[model samples]
Target: MSEWLSVCVAISLLLSLVTATAAYMLYSGLIAHINVLTGSPPIKKITFAYKFRQGLYRNCGQLFRESHNIGPKLPCIGVFYDDPNEVPGPQCRYVVGSILSEGEKDADKELQKRYEASGFQVFSFPEVTHVVTCWFPNRTFFSSLLGVRRVYPRLARYIKERRLCAHPFLEIYREGRIHFMGPLARQGDFYVPEVRRAERRLSEEDELHSDSDVSGVDSNSEYSSGSGVLLSDSRETSPADSWVHSPPQQDGGDRGSRRRSSGEVSFKELDWEQSGGQQQQQQQEGTEVEPRPEPSQKSPEAPTQEWWGVSGEE
Candidate 1:
């Protein structure tokens, strides 16, 4: 009985040890698996997010650069009208207000030039109403197009307010055209550089001219005759004799109109009429004059005797 009891006790002890070992192994495996999953739960997700964001930033930056390069040159040229599926018929192909035709005497050539410069090929599909072809290599083309629209805020707003989308180039045509409406590409060197330099030089010259005029006035005031005298006093103090020699003040408009010589007088008849009246007056005075008189004879004798108040009698 003692041996059997001991055997049973030993068997129970072995079973307990095996159960504990199994439980420990299962718990350890579960902990390791949980730790493996939870330790860096978002590592893959974060990496993917970073890559996506980086790609987006790169694409956006590229688009901005391209937009700036082409904006000024394109000048908001586009096809007008809606209805994505509608194909534009040749007869329906009325060109709208595109910068392409602006300042270009030749319509077809100007249109062609704009496309070529943009690195885009012109594609006219008979099926599509208007497949406004833009030179786009892959999706970059779309991005650039979008950027082009965003480049000129004022122009874009004007277009939208007027629904220029209905007729892309028409408004511009009616408005007498737009030059490089936005940014310019490298081809700008053909005209922009020289034009800008000329404008800057003209502005500088204008400033210099203005400064020179101001300085000239100041110098004249400092050294010109009549300096340090009041304007009123200068005129009042001039000698009366000096008037014959002094030039009339320029401020009084033309002096020639103020005075005319007798030769320039048109009324010779009026002068003759006045002379006749004077002659009549002189004749009337002669008739009124009495004889100097015998009084002259009497008074003359008295004066001769009195030559010396001492008296000729004395």
Candidate 2:
């Protein structure tokens, strides 16, 4: 009788422990969800350093790692630009990096410069309004996974229910919490210039590809007329004229096949950009660009800025 009683007590304790643990997790999650629903993320005017990347969001872990390794405990942020369900993983765009300052508590100028030297782009967003925000605890890596899984669905539902035009979702991790924010206004402001240009160029390329497909035009036959030139309506347009070079398609050639994105800067490209940037700064140093006359310039307009395999036509 005593043995049976002891076994029963042990089983009851085990059940109680399991029940308490489960309830604690559930309660924590429930509280976070409720707070997120009612909370407003504080996205004040701030300076940030970020590296933009075009790839799967899952792959953005590397960016986070790099940022954290560089500036541990600094507020880190991830900006996602597409829904995986709607956009292909390969086409998704994102930027991840650390915040340099918020109002006061400014970071060291040298620190900011260091980050920039390491291929991170720096920008400041003025105080913006109509921002939708929420936060989740990030005590562990698992918290990030949990926060993403729980928060996004609620955010989507909330936006859908209210018919809000929030865009370019942001996840800001600071002081063991992740604040999710999406701005209803100035949504375009968050997209860096490179990303904007990339999107525009990509759309143009997609249109061109679709037209070729619809017209059943042989890509090979047209380019054969000239080296890296496309003959359209008796006009020869060299690929070199564009911001990005679209080399003539060679038989089974992988060289010049893949394009480099803003985030994926190569060592050679970095050296070239350093040289180019120095030259550009020198050209405009002590010169007034804001007061330039429209339609008539004393000197020829600075060569249209060209970059990464894309036309600089503006």
Candidate 3:
């Protein structure tokens, strides 16, 4: 009985240990997930500018007004990687950025110098269109992961809103110079005014050519109508030629008689032609033209038929 009780207690202890281990693992995973989602900034010694900028964004409307005209409010993302308590002040890093646009190399270098002078380690990417608030840090896998989650969403949103076609987002660390991590959301060349102008010119030229072709067609049609010779010789004959070729008439009466004779001859010819055509049509159809019945006439009465007799009563 004692051996059985000892065995049961040992089994219970083993079960409790397993449960505790599982719970600890689950709790750690939950915390890690929360950290990833929230993108909590790492502990780092940041400058007053970094803190002020963050506070400004948090209370943007209440603390700052549009009257300040600091340009449009851009999407900003924080980047930090070292624990200030562990790293020395000069070695710690903190970074943030809001504006992103094409930057000149010389200008970027100048900006970097200016920021470094203010005790900030700025990452200036000429290829990348971004304004970052950066500082030094102790590199770690977890810090890098946190930075990606924190910055990627903001960078993607900025690219989409601005319709940026091509931009670089990458970071490298070598020779004590720290390059921060960034994301390129799209792939293509940036827009240029020259390309747009060239397209517009080509379209305009095409339109002009089309207009010219249409105008040529219209002009050719007009020219043909105006300069074309009469196809029929009969159309070319004038009224004067007919009058001159005709025999001379002594007076208007002779002219009128000639015209009447010609007209009568034409009328007789037309009547003969019409009759022949009607006979041919009837033969073709195998039908005879039935004669119309004449109206009946009353017979003449004899002179003696009108004899009348006086009434006997009269």
Candidate 4:
């Protein structure tokens, strides 16, 4: 009988512990899910000490811990620069730090200097008219996780429904709440300098790759500015070569059209052709049409169908 009683007691204790843990989780989620607001948040600006990092955002908890250890009881802020759904986990960018000043309040210059001396960067969010704001309960350590899991989805939905261009999500842990903020205006102001530098580096790399790729093209051929016309690089001296006629890519494009060949058709208009090629432009149907002057009695020396002009005589 005593053995059975002990077994019952053990089972009861296990059930009680499970119930308590479940209850606590539900309570934490409930606390984090409240006070969901999406609009202009009541903040003009914020000054913060930050450490920029690039990688999975889920790993940002370590950053929070580090900031907290250095500046306990201080408000911490996280600026997330990429959507995990759109960007790769390893490529996500974020800056985490402690807030020294916000709005009209005086900054803790000593704390700012301390963080700066510790190799942390000092940065500020510019004043914005509107922002998406929400808060999650920070009653316990688990609250941060719950808040992130709960608030971010709803915040994303709200922004999508309203078509608000909120970006570079900001999370501020202060006063027992994890305040979520994203600017609807001046959204670019939130990106840290590190992010800009990284982006510039990426763009420069892309440009360099494009340059290398373009350099290996056909040695004799080159692409035109527009009109997608393939200009043949034929430079053989023919009877019609001297009277080179190349039309502008567009109807109202530059009146002077240079031939794709080497130093051929360099002149804007030949002596026999009207200035600016206005007469030929009206007769052309498509974008590119070489205009050739008709034979007339006034110029008996006019080149025939072969257009045997200066190059022909030579």
Best candidate, TM-score-wise? Answer: 4
In the range 1-314, model 2's lDDT, one tens digit per residue, is: 99999999999999999998777666445346434443344768778999987655566777888888878868888765544433344654567889999875687798788888899999776556576667777765556655665566566556556645455457788877778776655555666666656645543554465454534443222111011111010011221121111222211111111232233235546666766676677667964333321111111111011111000111
Position 199, candidate 2: lDDT: 48
Global fold similarity of model 2 (TM-score): 0.58
Residue-pair clashes per prediction, in order, are: 14, 6, 5, 0
lDDT of 1 by residue, 1-314 (tens): 99999999999999999998766544433122111010111101000000001111113333223323443343332221111112111211111112333221333665455445755333221111221111211122232222222222223333334322111111111122221121111111111122223334533543454445633232111111110101010011121111001121211111011122233233544565666676678778884433221110000000000000000000
TM-score of each: 0.15, 0.58, 0.18, 0.66
Which of the two, 3 or 4, has more TM-score?
4
Over 185-280, each residue of candidate 4 has an lDDT whose tens digit, in order, gives 554466577766654454354345444554444222322211111111111112111111122211111111111332223332354456347646
Off by over 4 Å in 4: 30-32, 211-314
Checking candidate 2 for backbone clashes, the offending pairs are 242-311, 243-310, 243-311, 244-309, 244-310, 245-309
For candidate 1, what is the lDDT? Answer: 0.24
List RMSD in Å for every model shown.
Answer: 43.0, 18.3, 45.3, 21.5
Model 2 segments beyond 4 Å from truth? 1-31, 36-41, 104-106, 206-314
Prediction 1 TM-score vs. true: 0.15
Whole-model lDDT per candidate: 0.24, 0.53, 0.27, 0.53
Ranking by TM-score: 4, 2, 3, 1
